[model samples]
Structure formats: structure tokens, C-alpha cells
Target: MRKIILLLLLSAFISGCSSLSKSQIETVQQFGEVTSNFSAYPSAIMEELAEIRLKRGLYYASTLTDPMRHLDELDSIYSQKKYDYKVSEKIDVTFRVLDKYAQSLVLLSSGDYTANLQNNAAEFGVGMDSLVNLYNVKSNAEKLPAGIGEALGKIVGFSGDRYIKVKQSEKIKEYVTKADTLVLIMTSNLLEYLESSNLEELISYEEKMIRRNYLTYLQLTDTGTFESQREYLDLKSNLDAAKDLKALTIQSTKDLQAAHKELVQVVQKKQKLHSTIKELRVFYQQVAEIRETLNALKKDK
Candidate 1:
């Protein structure tokens, strides 16, 4: 009878130790999904910018008096553009590493703790360092804070250690507290890059150039040819699509930041995530709209 009572007590303790509620698990899973999807936006946006530049160059080359004579200069331009895209790819990879870290949090909630998850977390830290180095070497903008990379690595690595030592509910609260800072840094840097860089400027400039290009042609030919008008409308449509996408991407980033903060509060304070989950849903819808815009642009191309 003493053995039976002891066994019952042990079972209750085990259950109590592992009591990550189903709702909490679902919340972490949704956070992982939304963040991972959002992380890919930078790469997609960079590709879209590259496409716009390529089209603008081709159209301008067609109008040149001697396009063949400037082939060497155009080649140089293409090479530089390719290099820019490479930098963007590194940025994309870094964001993905953060996404991976978020997934690790989900793993904790699901109680599927991996023995080697720390290695994956360490890799993400290394990726963050590499990203900062690439940006510092290639960009003239103010360098990112020197400690930001190391700090992210440490937080992520520590979170892995805590996951193994702590109960799921406690680990999540601690992880979210540390990870909220990383999320802020990443999302802020991305939004800053979009706002301060020439990418958005280029898109706006292209819109103006398109208007002028069509207007000039219309003036030269008293009757605006069907081919010219149709081409003008198509080019205008592309620019409008890009602008719309940029707006949505910026808003989505903002929503992502808010969602992460709310998640931290929900986890730490043991609050329901009704509004936090709703915000994530809105973010997902924005991401879907961004995808649809990109697909439409591709079809137009």
C-alpha cells in the first residue's frame, strides 16, 4: 500500500512538471509558422527589386542611340547588381536562423526536446555574426552595434541550455523574455534597411520615369500607338504592384514585432493569446497578399 501511494504521488509530480497546456503549444506553433514565413520576405523583396532594375535597364538600352557601344558599361552594372543581391541573400539567411531559433521554442513546448538542438542554436549565432560582418564590409551605412550579433548568439544558446534544464512552461517564459530582444533587433534592422536604402527610392524613381517615358512617346507621335500605350500601362502596373507590396511588407513587419512582444507577455504572465493570435493571423494574411502580388508580377513578366 505504501508503494502504491508513492507511485501515485510520482505520477502526479511528473504530470505537474510537464504541464504545458495545449493552448500554449498551439500559440508557439503559430508563432513559429508566422515568423518563418515572414523571414523570407527580405529575399523575395530583393529579387523583386532586381527584376525592376533589370527591366528598367533593358527598356533604357532599347532607347539608347548606340546600345551596343555601351555593352561594357551595362555589363559592369549587372555585375554590381548581382553583388547587391548576394548581400541580400546573406540577410535572408540570417533571418532564417532566427526563424530556426523560434522553432526551437516550439520544440520545447511540444516536449520533443532534441539532444543536439544546441548545435543548431549555435549555428544560428554564427550566421548572425556573418550577416553583420557582411553588412559592415559592404554597406556604407552606420554599422550595426558591435555586440548585437554576439548577444543574439548568447541568448539563443542560453535558451537551448535552459530548455533542457527547465519545465516547458518555465522554459518558454524565460526563452520569450530573452528572444524578445533578438526579435526587436532583427525586425528593426530590416525595417531600417527598407526605409533608408535606395530600393524604395528606385521604385519611386522608376514610376516617375515610366510616366515620362510614355508621355515623351505620346508627344513625339501625335497618335499614341496601341503598342506604346499598352507597354506604358503594363510598366505602370508593375511599379504600382511593387509599391503596394512594399507597403504591405512594412506593415507586416510591424505586425510581426507587435506579435512577438505580445507573445512574450502572454507566456510570462500566463495570459490568453486571443489578441496576439489575431495579430498573427493578420500578419499571415498580409504575407498571403504579398505572395499574390509577387505571383501577379511574375505572370506579367
Candidate 2:
């Protein structure tokens, strides 16, 4: 009888172990930069609302309350950070976290997961801390890295589809859905202000007055004699340019109204996004595919 012994050895590639391609890095940077100007939109509406309320009086007079009550309500929403700022800051922080994840993935792709994991993990926690600070609800920053870890886990599994499915957890879906909801609320209020208040008329009147002033200025410049013929010709040329501003202003107001109407239609169509989980899954999968392509690029390099 002969004694027999068998042994097996295999290599496992850890996640984030490839070098990144230029396009991959650019995509990550671009994705990070794409963010909604949530606060600006609402702030603009509030400013318009306040101006119109002062110029034309509040949207409507209540049977009982301060006459500026409606304007005050808008002010309160803006000042209290109940919606606009909340939504804006929240989305911005989310973008930051995503950028961090993208960077961490790059590190992993570079075959430096274990060495960089500690510091990368710390950055993720800090990012989450910034994020949770914006919300009224509580969240542990440590909880965030777990998701990053899970995403990193996909490296070993080598299954992008499965990884995407894992990202579609209920918690993540709810967060994405709620973020979208916040935007809807912010935009809806703007449309409501436009429809219910005197903002449209106020804006139009203000623009009309501005155009009138430009015309008045043009007449004054034309009537005045210049020291030289070139001076007079230059003034005349600039006058044409100044007159064109009136047309631009008109177009700007029309464009605003068009955007306002389009937002209204979108809100009507996808009221709450009951399939929020599916939406998130699809979105995350796209991000994942980008990451995958990035890994492949680095590997080829």
C-alpha cells in the first residue's frame, strides 16, 4: 500500500486591485460633479415670492392672520432649513460620498485594498458623518462603510449583476426616493407660488420697466453730442447691444415659465415613484457598470 497526499493552492484577487484608465477616472469625476441645484431653484422662487408679495401684496389675503403671512410662510421654510437647504445640502453630501466611493474603488483596482482600506474607510465614515449631520434622523457613519465594503466585496465575487442586486437594498432605495421627493416638494412650491401669487405679473412688470429705462437711456445717449464722431458711433453701437438685453430678458422669463410647467407635468406623472427600489437598482447598476469598465481599463493598462 502507498500513502497518497493531495494539496490545492488557489489565488484570490481582492477587490480594488486594478489600475484605472483615464476615461474611468474622468467618468468618476463627472458623476461626482453632476448634482441638482436644489437650493438655488427654491431660493430664487422665494426671492421672487417676497418681492411680489411686497410689490403686489401676498398671494392671497387670509380671512384671519398677518397680511404677509403667506410670504412669511415661504420665508419660514427657507430660513428654518425645513426643505430647500435641507434638500440641497443632503444631495450635495451624497455626491461627496459617491465621489469618495469612486476614489476608493480606484484604490482597490490598483491592488492596494488592504493597505489603503483603513484610511479609505475612515474617509467614508467622515463623509457619512457629514451626511447624517444634515438630517433630523440619526445615522451611524460606521454603517456607511459597510455598504462600501459590500460593494468592494463584489471584487472577489466577480459578479457585477449580483453586486448591483445587493445595492438595491430597501434602505438605499428609500434614501434615493426620499431625496427625489424633497426635490419635488421644493419645485412644486415654486410652481404653486407662480400660479397662486402675483410673481408672474411682478416679474413681467419689473422687466417692462427695465426695458423702458434702457430705451430712455438710449434716447438720452442719442440726443447728447459726442466730442468725436467715433465716440458717437461707439455709443450708437452699444445702444443696440443694450436694446438687445430687453429681448433676452423676455426670453428668460418665458423659459422660466416653460420649465415651471414641465416640472408640474413630471410631478403629476411620477407622484411617489412606487418602484423606487427598481429605479435605484437601475441607477446603481449604471454606476457599477462604470466602475466595472474602469476596472477593465486599468487591467488592460
Candidate 3:
């Protein structure tokens, strides 16, 4: 009877151990499934967002050249009026090439290209806002030339005593100063965005292809030169920092909430810098136009 009782006790112990092992295995499998689902979903969403944002940015940059195209059209019109068919044809051909280039940029922007899955999508919207602001500035700058003649006429037509002339001169100065302030504000906003954004590294890799573009506007504006070389260097630094950030981000990935928050901050900074660089381009273009107009007026005199 004692032997039978001991055997029964051992049998029960073995059964309990097997049940515990099975339970543990199920728990681990469930955990893994949860992790896999979380990782895949967020990564896929982020990648799609990044691609869209990059394309949008590139497209906006291409569109920013509409002013230059319009300027070419004006030049062609003037050349035609002067019976300079050769110059007009040349301008038209150049305009066509520019249009094609712009279209290509749009296509490239829209093309299916790979983007870092970890990049933050919300920050991209901020960058887009900066680009929109730049577009508005460019539009305003284009309108300035049309109003300049009228403003100048108003100043010249005002025949008053010396005191009145002095007042008018001050008023004109105020108007010019206000316009300049707006340009400066827009330029500063753009620079701030670039400096804050970490995208400097990405831009640097593409700088070789973009250097000529950088130089063209720099020559036209007095806003200050863009050191393409410096930009490249900064971009390299950012890339190194980004590697460290990526590591931190990856480690924290298991904690989805924390990782998401950290990455968002990193991406926001990068977008800021991207926006700044774009704004700087617009500022340079505007300044160039102003300089050209001044030169033309001097020649006319």
C-alpha cells in the first residue's frame, strides 16, 4: 500500500511539470508575435510617409523656379519687340529646357525611391510649411518690380517744401526698409530651419550636383554667400550624429512609445534645417533680382 501511494505522488508531480513547460512556450510565442506585428506596422507606415515627404519637397523646389521662367518670358517678349529674333529664339529654347528640367524634378520627386523607415513623418509637414512660406516670399518679391516704378513716380512727383521732401524721403525709406525687413525675416527663418534640421547630411551628399545652383543665386544676392563646402562638412557631422541617434533609437525600439517620441524629435530638427536651406535659396534669388534691377537703372541713367 505504501509503494502504491508513492508511485501515485510521483506521477502527479511529472504531470504538473509538463503543463508548466507548455504554458511557458505559449507565452513566449505570443510575445514574439506581438513584437513582430508592432515592428512591421510602424516601419511600413514611416517608410511610406518619408517617401511622400521627400517627393513633395523636391517638387516644391522645382516649382520655386516659376519666377525665373516668367523672367525669361519677359525677356523674350522684349527681344521680340526689338526684332531680335535670334535672342528671342534662344530665350525660348532655354525656357523649354528649364521647363523640361522642372518636369524631370517633379518626376524624380514622385518616383518610387527608398527612404529610411525610421524617419519621422510629422516633421515632414513642418518642412512643407517652410517651403510654402518660401513660395509666398518669392511671389511677393516678383511683384515688387511692378510696384517699384509706381512707388518711384510717387516719390518724384511729390513737389513740396524742403520739409515735405524730407518727410517723403523718410516715408520712402520706411517702405524700402520694410520690404528689406521682410526679405531678411524670410531668409533668417529658412537658415534657422536648416541649422535645426538634421537633413544637412542628406543635402551634403547631393551638394556636388547642387553646387552650381548654390553659386548662381549667391552671385545674384547680397544676402551673404552659402558655403557649399561648409554645408557639406556640416552634413558629414550630422550624418555621424545621426548614426548615434539611430543606435539609440533602435535600442529603444522595443519600447515603442519612447522610441517613437525620440525619433520624432530627431526628424523635426532635420526638417527644420531642410526648410531653412530652401528659404535661403529663395532669398538669394530675390536679392539677385533686386541687384539686377539696380544695375539696369544705373545703365539707363
Candidate 4:
């Protein structure tokens, strides 16, 4: 009777220790990979805004009373203390903090954490601390709660030759629960920026300018030259491409936010790992498409 009871207790303990299956860990790794990939997009969008403004300024310079003076003014405005540029810098920092967090997630879930575990954990903790500090300085916001760093430190600080699945689940659940709100804030800020009227207004103004210029040229020339028509077509093509990219970027950002929310649910065991996997794979594919589009645009430039 005593032997049977001891065997039953041992079996229960072993079962409890196997909380996070291999598939679940792999799903987490996928989530981290997609997150790291997605981090560059917001900064790129800001760059696109600056580029468009500069191009628009140059295009309209001929209409100004003193064209040369207008050109100088445009240069100065863009070069010094522009509000949009300042906002862009803050956006960059916000994404950096997010990317760092995603990287820590990858490191924790990866098989490599077993080697030099303490040193690696401490190193990641320091990196997280630095990013959080940068976020505070750049955004002029209160510092993120210290608990996020502390919880993450605990996640990586475990000692053992074998990676413990049960501990991973526990620490990840705690971290995800605490970090979910912060993640939502970062992602929501991005969505708000993207959905704002500033970008749409800029794009609309540029389209009108392009069309007006082309029409004026046609009227003066009584059927424009091949070069003129080609220029108009090229301009239109670029504008169309930019518009398409904007739509994709917005969708991708939403997908990222949704995936992170799903991650929180998965960690809490409120959602099945398989269901999360499907969503993650979809996000991964969408990001890959965005990457390809960005690359094509760069090459065209």
C-alpha cells in the first residue's frame, strides 16, 4: 500500500512538471520572430512621411513668390526641430523597447538558455532596463513598472542543466499578465498614429498636387511630350504604391496587436496552443509579404 501511494505521488508530480509542451514553446518562438520582424515598420512609416513632405515642398517651390527663398525655408523647416521628426524619434524608441522584450522572449524559449543561464539572464535584464529608461526619456512618460524587469529576470534566472517546462509556464504566465497592458499601450499608440488624419491629409494633398501639375502641363502644351506623360505616370505609380503600403502597414500592425493578445490568453491557458498557432502563422505570412513589398519599394527608389 505504501509503495503504491509513493508511485502515485511521483506520477502526479511528473505530469504537473510537463505543463508546457514542445509545440507550445515552438509557437512562442514563432511569435517572437514575427514581433522582431514587425518592429521596423513604424519607424519606416515615419521616414516615408518625411520623404513625402520634402518631395511635396520641392514640387511646389516654383509657385512661391521667391522660389529660392521658399526652397531655403523648406530646408530649414525640415532640418531643425520639426514636430513630426520629434514624434518619429519617440516612435522609434517605443518600438525599440518592444523589440527588446520580444528578443528576451525568444531567448527564454530557446534551447540555448540552458548554457550560461545566469549570465544570459542578467545580460538580458540589463538590456531591458536600458530600453525602459530610454522609453521614459524619449516619451516624457513615467518609467515602466520595475516589476516587468523583475519578473523577466526571474524567468531567466532559474538554475538547472535541464530547462524546466513547468517553471517556464509559471514565469511566462506571470510576465505576460503583467506585460499585457504595456504591450497594448504601445500597440494602441501605433494604431492611433497610423489612423490619424495627418498621413491621409498628406497623401491627399500630394495626389491633388500631382494631378494639378500634370493637368496644367497638358493644357499649356496642347498634348504633353512623351517625357512629361511618363513623368506623370511614374508619379502616379509611386503614389499608388505608397497608398497600398499604408493599408498593408495598418493591417499588419493590427495583426501584431491581436497576436500578442492571443499570446496572453495562451499563456494563461485560456486558449489552446493550436488555435494560437494558426493565428501566429497567418501573422508571419502577412509580415513576410510586407517585407517583400518594402524591399521592392526600396529597390525602386
Candidate 5:
């Protein structure tokens, strides 16, 4: 249905228009690509990071010679996800906001000016909807900050192409910049928390390993005193080493988290994102306001 509408609309707008012009193919295509880039919730990322962190601690504990050495060997494993986090953070704000800008033009071009209009539940694309859910916007009454959903809705009602004149006015520039800043801040915070969570979890894993080792030794068979005594000494030594490693990991985690206190506050509270998102939904509200501001600017021009 969307493709049909676009095809019909394209007949009028496809000629003599710059490819990347506001409502042209390039803008829509770019938006589609960017929209597809949305992946992983912040909470999910942190959870996985926590798990991997614990897993590494266990792996390290298994290597009695040097735990950090085993962790160092996991460089390849950790780097892959690290790259993803970096790429996700580098979202094309210029294109994303322009996508929103172009969508507004499409709506305005067709005389569809109702705020937050939607053709169907699926119109906003998975990217925007995931964002909507991530932000915990339960209903339409819960206005999204920064006009994100509304901006998406504005575009959704206009699949048919028209020779829409889209321009980047000053307010639009501010809107784009603000949106990009929010994305950067959001991604950075998530990645930072992931880093910290991984470190913190390692400490936890080490503590558990220490306790489990102690219990296992307690249940050991009553072999000769020599064998039993040596096993007990080795267990105690391993426990001491684990405790030291845990202390170091804890200090490192705390230090890193403290350095990014503001971002931490944005991404989490009590190991979850529900409360953080509720508080941070204000940023979405700010985004929506920018969309309105951009509209007013377009009108003024």
C-alpha cells in the first residue's frame, strides 16, 4: 500500500527535482536506511554486557595462572560488540532530522496538517516505534518529547510523492542539531553504562567463585592429611587472589561510572531503564517542541 501510494505520487514529483532534495527519493531512501539502523534497547545492551562480564570473570578464574591473561585473550569477542556500539552511536543526525523535515513537507504538501496523524499502527517503521516503546510512551495522551512520533506520523500519511519544497530553515537547523545531540548523548550513556556494568559484574562473579570454591573444598573427601592440607591451602590462596581481583574490578568500575555520572543517571537506576526512561522522556518532549518550532519557521518563510 505504501509502495503504491509512493508510485502514484512519484509521477508528479520525480521529474526535474534534485535527487536529495527535501521530498525527493534520496531523502526518503536515506530516512529508510537510518530508520533501519535502530537496534537494541539500552537495557538489553547493559544486560548482555553484564552477562559477558560475568562470563569473562569465570573464564579468568578457570585460568589459575593469570585471570587477566584470559580476559585479554577475549579481545576479539569484545571488539565486535564494541564496534557495533560505536556505529550505532554515530547515527546520521543530519539525515535523520532531514528525514523528519522531509516528512513534514510531504504532509504540508498534501494539506494534511493534523498533529500526530497516523494511517495505521505500522506506518512509523520499526525504528521509530521501537523508540516509542523504549521511551515508554504507553498511549497517545503521553506526548513524546521532541515531536519524534508526531514527526514520524506526519511523514507516514504522505506515501504519495509530490513536488514538496523542503528547505532547511534556522529553526530546522536547531531542531536537527538538538535531535543529533540527544542521539549522541543517549548512545554514549548506554555504552558507558555497559562498560561499567561489565566491570561491576566481574567483581560479583569473582565473589561467587570464591564462595563456591570454599563450599566445594568443605565437601572434599577425607583423603590423607597431606592431600587434604595441600588442597585446603590452594583453595585459600585462590580465594585470596579472587578477592583481590574483585576489589580491583570494583574500583575500576566505580571510577569509570563516576566519570560519567550524568550519562549514568540518564541510562539507568537500580539496574533497570524503566525509571530512567520515564524521567528522560522529557527529552522526547523537547524533540516534539523542536518539530513545532520548525513548522513555525517554515510558515514564517
Candidate 6:
């Protein structure tokens, strides 16, 4: 009777150990999977965000040269209304994707946790509640700005196509500043997450995206064709500067701070470029209106 009891006890202990090991493995695997998926969300969002910013910057630059010219008419346009609408639509699409992704993550994590718990009935396990909280954090982060881009699209009206000369105007500058600030916020938020996760590969990817965005902005602002040596040189210089900054090693806190400072400078430059474009746009519109009036008077005569 004593030997039989000892054998039974040993079997139960072995089973408990096996159950615990399996449960731990499941938790780690689930955590890794979720975090990896979560990391991709910001990268996707940033790509769109960068494109919007660059487009807006180019539009502003073009408008600065000719106040009478409308953005839609420019070879490269910067109509807030159009951009905003597109951004809004994109936001809706992104939100839906995020919603589905979050839901799936929750279901998977819960299922895994539940199965593990059942297998180890004697021990308390990490609840699905914690995983739910993680999903909520990611979802909220992604959902907040989907509508703002759309709202901006509705406010700007059609101006016409002409090469607007760059002008220095306060109101135009203000709008540019506001738009650039929004972009900065988006980029900063993304960088913060990447930095926190210490994911070097993702950080490198983001840096490349940022550089591409800046290059697009430069291209839009340059009015002279590829044939214009001056314009080409200017564009090349800006591109090189942007690329150098992007490639710089940022391994320490100091490096990050320096990089941030540079980013601020870039935002300021974009604001200035936009301001110049806006002034030109307004000027071209005024000129075109005058010309139309003159032609109408001639016909009346």
C-alpha cells in the first residue's frame, strides 16, 4: 500500500511541472507575436503621414511664386481641401484595419491563455484582462487623428493652375506652421514608440521613410525643371543634407536629442517653404481675377 501511494504522488508532480512549462511557453509566444504585430502599425501609418506632409509642403511652395494660380492647376499641387479629403478617407481605412487587427490579437491571446489555464488547473495564470489592456492602448493610439485630415480637406476651395512666385506672407506662414507641427507630432509619436521598443531594424526603416518624405518636399518646392541647373543643384544639396542626417548613428540619449533638434529645424524650414508657396498662390489668384475683368471690359466695349 505504501509503495502504491508514493508512485501516485510522483506521477501527479510530473504532470504539474509539464503543465507549468507549457503555460509559460504559451504566454511568451503570444507576447512576442502581439508586440511584433503592434510594431508594424506605426510604420504603415508613418508612410502615409509623410506623403501627406510632403505634398502639402510642395503645394505651399508652388503657391508662393504666383498668388493668382490655383493649387490644382500646378504640375504639383498643394490644395488642403483635396489633401484633407484623401487623408480622411485613408484614416477610415486605417481605423478599420486597426480595429480588425486588435480584435484578432485579443481573441488569439485569450484563446491561448485559456487553454493554458485549463491545462494547469492547480496554478493561477496570467489573465486575458492584461492582454486586452495592451490592445486597447494600441487601438486608441491609432484612432485619434483619422478625422482631422478629412476636416482640413473640406475648408480649402479651388484656386486655378499657374506657377505662383514665392512670397513672404504672415497668414500663409501661419497655416504652413500649423500643418508642419501636425506632421511633427505624428513623426514624434512614431519615433517614441520605436525608441522605446529598442527595435533597430524598425528604426532604420523609419529613418529611410523620413528621408524620402523630405526629398519629396524638396522636389515639389523646386520650380525650375531638371534643365535649370540652379534648381537642380539646390534640390541636390537639400537631398544630400537630408540623407546625411538620416544616416547618422543615434545610439545614445545625446544623439537622440541632437536628431530631435535637427527634426525641429526641418519642420521650421517646411513651414517657411509653405508660407512662401501660399503667398504666391494668393497673388496669382488676384492677378487672374484682374485679367478676367480686363477681358470682360474689352468685350463690353
Q: State every prediction's TM-score relative to the real structure.
A: 0.70, 0.28, 0.20, 0.75, 0.30, 0.23
Predicted candidate 3 versus true structure: per-residue lDDT over 1-301, tens digit per residue:
9999976875564444322122222222222222222222212222322332332233223334578874665555454334421222322322232222222222212212213210221233233334334444444332221221122223232232333333333323332332333223333332332243443443444334344434443454433325544543443344333333333323333233222222223222312222223332343343344334334433422
On the 0 to 100 scale, the lDDT of residue 17 in model 2 is 25
RMSD of 4: 5.0
Per-residue CA lDDT of model 6 for 1-301, tens digit only, reads 9989976885564444322122322332332233223323333333333433454345345435555554444434334334423433333333333333223223332332333432331111122222223433555454232322222122222221110101111112222233233333333444454355434453345445444544554576654455444433433443333233222211221232333333233324422222223322333343344334334433422
TM-score of candidate 4 against the unseen true structure: 0.75
Cα lDDT, all candidates: 0.63, 0.35, 0.32, 0.67, 0.37, 0.34
Q: Which stretches of candidate 1 lie over 4 Å from their true place?
A: 1-18, 65-70, 83-97, 106-166, 211-231, 269-276
Which parts of model 3 have CA positions greater than 4 angstroms off? 1-217, 220-222, 225-237, 240-301
Model 5, backbone clash pairs (residues 3+ apart or across chains), number = 11
Instruction: Rank candidates by lDDT, best first.
Output: 4, 1, 5, 2, 6, 3
lDDT (10s digit) by residue, model 5, range 1-301: 9989976677655554432323222222333232222222222223333433444334333443456674665664466446433423222332243244334323322323233433421254334535534443333233334544443333333333333222112222223333443344444443444356654564466456645644443444223356545544444444344434333333332332232233333312223222323322333333334334334433422
What range of 10 consecutive residues in model 5 has the weakest lDDT sum?
165-174
Give lDDT: candidate 6, residue 219: 70
TM match of model 1 to true structure:
0.70
What lDDT score is found at residue 127 in candidate 3?
A: 34
The TM-score of predicted model 2 comes to 0.28
Best candidate, lDDT: 4
- CA lDDT of 206 in candidate 4? 73
Where is model 6 poorest over a 10-residue stretch in terms of lDDT? 160-169
Off by over 4 Å in 4: 1-15, 59-90, 133-145, 155-160, 163-165, 212-232, 270-276
lDDT of 1 by residue, 1-301 (tens): 9999977886666555544455665787677765665666666666666665665554544444566755864786588579657645435545754666566555545544454554554455566566556655655555544433343244333333344434546556665666676677677767876676587677777777766655654555455668756766887787788778788888888887887887775665544444446766776788788888888988987
Give the per-residue lDDT digits (tens) of candidate 2, residues 17-114: 23233333333233223222222332334333233223222112211145577567556545544432233443344434434433433433332334
Q: Could you tell me the lDDT of residue 193 within candidate 5?
A: 44
Clashes of each: 0, 8, 9, 0, 11, 30
